[model samples]
Target: MAVNRACHLIEELGCGTVLNGMLDYYPTKEEVQKVTVNPQRINKLLGVNVPMDQFINILERLEFKCNLISSDKLELEVPSFRLDITEDADILEEIARIYGYENIPAADLEGNATAGVKTENQKFMDKVKENSIACGLNEILTYSFVSPRGVDKINLPENDEKRNFVKIMNPLGEETSVMRTTLIPNMLNVLATNVSHKVEEAYAFECGNTFTPQNGLPVETKKYCIGMYGKEVDFFSLKGIVETILNNVGLKGYEIESETTNSTFHPGRCAKVVYNNICVGTFGELHPDVIENYNLGQRVYVAEINADLVFENITLVKRYSALPKYPSTSRDIALIVKDEVFVKQIEDIIKANASDILESYKLFDVYKGSQIEEGHKSIAYSITYRSAEKTLTDEDVAKVHDKILSELSEKLNANLRSN
Candidate 1:
């Protein structure tokens, strides 16, 4: 629904929390170092001035040694039991709590309160979820941190970039020991679980983040994925799902071509989604080895989209135009090309030669049988012609139609289907 730059951000005014703070923590075993405390800073922060003597007395009663090194500063030795008092802010909060928080009269909050609203990127993802749900996919969420074994499970190569994992120094367990570079493993795990539970079929999607290790930091990239395993699932059905999302996002001049090299997917069944010559996604049925690795009994299909790429390229502004007033004419043509010829190749020829009056064309049928020659196939299309200035006569439409057929014959060696 919208385009967003960078990751979603919150411009908090007075928070001291660092975004890239360390996750690893090691508690001291022997003793905590003495905290450098300032009574004036405590008072300024808490907005209540208490005399230094009173501060020292209150801490002493709590079994703390407040050795005054300056008029306003003290080298405070915390009680052995107060192991949490390792930082000055911790000691300040303790003083406030002991001084009775109810006694400090509350003042009006500073500045204006910012009303929470969804970011444009957040709204776009929400739209993706809704549209996917309408297409009959159940929304599912999986953990960002997953086992390192996932890379192996998918049979990624040794030099694959996904093998560069952001390992957790203190993970929950071995299963959650590394940040995910791809959602394929998680999706496979989900589909595998459903089969284990004896579910007949599953169609699920996730719009989430994938972490890529970049220059010793985990860079968050948004990803959208769909996984399905059922008697109803097939390559073309999954392709339809992909096309629906692409059109819904308003992309143009995109290409879907065959892919064969990815180890995770079945060769010849996989295809990449490219827009403006940039590959934004890959989708296909699982390789037989992958199916065995996941212990899945049924064939599975998966699709992954670099949603960050889509977010960057999507155009939210839609133009409007009135319906055509003049009558439109239609033409049905069937042509035969070699077995190796792609539908897009024929379409390219038609589009290149068609005149301005050619409004649209749709593939109505494709035939391969005894009536057709071996090592070739027959394809049919219903072409429409119209004019903005006036209704197109049969003679006018025929000239353009003949021109397109001539080009197809010349460029692709296509023959008209007589049967």
Candidate 2:
């Protein structure tokens, strides 16, 4: 496992292919100054007993090249090809002792075998990008590194699991020290630049890997970041844009609630877009603080959806919903209930009492006034009742209506408005 892991690291570091024949020879060092080495990793994984002379002979015979090394082996110039190899003699010993070259086929091979169809996750992202592009969203690319101030400004959790990124060995400066916990900060940067250049109504999205902690390991999550900037942008417009994206991908029966607030959004204007009852992403008006931080001139409404959450919600076949053959009898009722009484709770009570008769329900008005008690609001809802079997009659609806009013009164202590 260690050898394979080392080989993988070497490959990632742009060392030649893992096979012995493909391995690039390190240049001889001009000076044998003590190079800082990760002694444990090197000794346990790459220690060798082969003579340095024999290793040099093997490399020389293969016409393998290296940096300047004197005959005495006292000092040698570091080879550019050996950038990934940190320790002195570690690279040479690894080449000499590790021997799997003879067994590998000499010819270049093609991976033609169909690796089962693209995973559902992959197809979902493809659909996300495709739909986003179709809706006039441009693809964006940004760095993962974020500054401390930037992180704080974006209101990231101090000990956030996602913010625990792999730190650089020697970071250039503090400004680029930490890995980004969220995409909003960088997206805001993009927005600032575009606004400065006089771009109007920018619609952009990005899909990339982000590092977050999972069981003490930095797990890479492939995430999609979306942003929108325009003078006229607002909550519902962005909601419409997101609905188009979600509906196109067939993740139906999702819900959004304005209660899910984030530091990046206007407190009353943000919503958490939930799918399968999981908090997947958010949509809202950019907070005044965020707008000022980015020096953005126009208001921008933005949303981000977890593509993985989306794909998980994807179904293999579309479920069908029958159109109402009978007219939906909708009733509007305004209840003066305590502010603490959730409209959702009242709606749920109505649905529970009405059983299958309630086809759909929506809250169209929420009022607070001197006519009502303090700390209480009047909520008005239009609930459409229908029956699957046949047209629902007024008498049939009245029976369910009485049941709904009774349930609401009992559950929420709500009083229905009287004419």
Candidate 3:
């Protein structure tokens, strides 16, 4: 059978040697001084008309033994398994695959065609993956090389600078030896491998690049991590899907705050997603020993974000307003305060004292227990009070909502939860 298909193409090309039985290939005066060949680079890469004695009769009918070495090169020899004929356009694609690309001749394709626009950081990461797939998430794409026990399974902290990473000196083991400096421990190990295959309710998300080892090179960044689990994933349902992917990346005044130094989150259910003032990421409820080190039986809720600081603080030009012709007056209030008062310090004391018909305020409700007292906590907000030239009544929002409930009762001593 043709010597068993030439001994399976000389043992699939690792062709060492095989004398009398026929398959002896050698070539190594530095692979015959690196097999040169240039009849004008085989007539400018096979556009054909290959002359110089038909390119030295197609290198002596492919037994390739050439020699001339320079009035335009030629040295040839190659055959220790023809290690991909090193260069000169791989011997002009092996002379257009043995000079029979139907005798070559198909030109017309030389220039001007352009029409491919996207950059503005790829249209702001495609509108942050179209608002994280319209909020139901599911994008996941893990492994920017992980597992240095993912910073001790996200318990991180012993001098945590995300446990300073970037190892992989030749890793293909020890669980991919390092590089990911946080993408929520591989998006909580892919939502704990889709909740161990039965997938109760995921939501996942990831938009990559994390590395951080600076100074010896490796700075990467561009993040966005998100995760979720079922049984109503908490921490305000992943802070309303990280404020709808930072309002689909056009970001804007951002601020979330409450995070207490990140031992992989959950210290008071976490927060910190600031903006113009930088911090740009962190969302909570995962640290129950990082959900039992990823066994993840429900309740996950995560968020990473800093998608390069929301692509350098987004808002790529947009300014439209003019539709308030009056009619807004909401007002709810409720206070009682002291569990270390911070509803962004009572919305920065109703935006530093009702800066004119307040028009927005939210925290719907947040009580503590037994009608609230021992160390206190009752919250509740609602506010809104608009006017673009008319109609905000209820005594025009009760005199700036009673001077924002009298400066949340004289600077956060709070107390007003009666009826």
| Candidate number achieving the greatest lDDT relative to the actual structure | 1
- Candidate 1 has its poorest 10 consecutive residues by lDDT at 1-10
lDDT of 2 by residue, 106-155 (tens): 55345876667887777778888898899888999888776657756656
Residue 42 displacement in candidate 2 (angstroms)? 43
Writing each residue's lDDT as its tens digit, candidate 3 over 94-165 gives 777777788898888779977798778978888888888888887878778877787888888788787888
Can you write out model 1's per-residue Cα lDDT over 299-418, one digit (the tens) per residue? 899999998898888888889977999999999999999977777788887788787887899887778999999999999999999999998998999899999999889988998988
Ranking by lDDT: 1, 3, 2
Between candidates 2 and 3, the one scoring higher on TM-score is 2
State each model's CA lDDT, in order.
0.87, 0.71, 0.80
Regions of candidate 1 where Cα sits further than 4 Å from its true position = 1-113, 364-374
Alpha-carbon RMSD to native, per candidate: 16.2, 15.8, 17.6
Give the clashing pairs for model 3.
none
Candidate 3's clash total is: 0
Give the clashing pairs for model 1: none
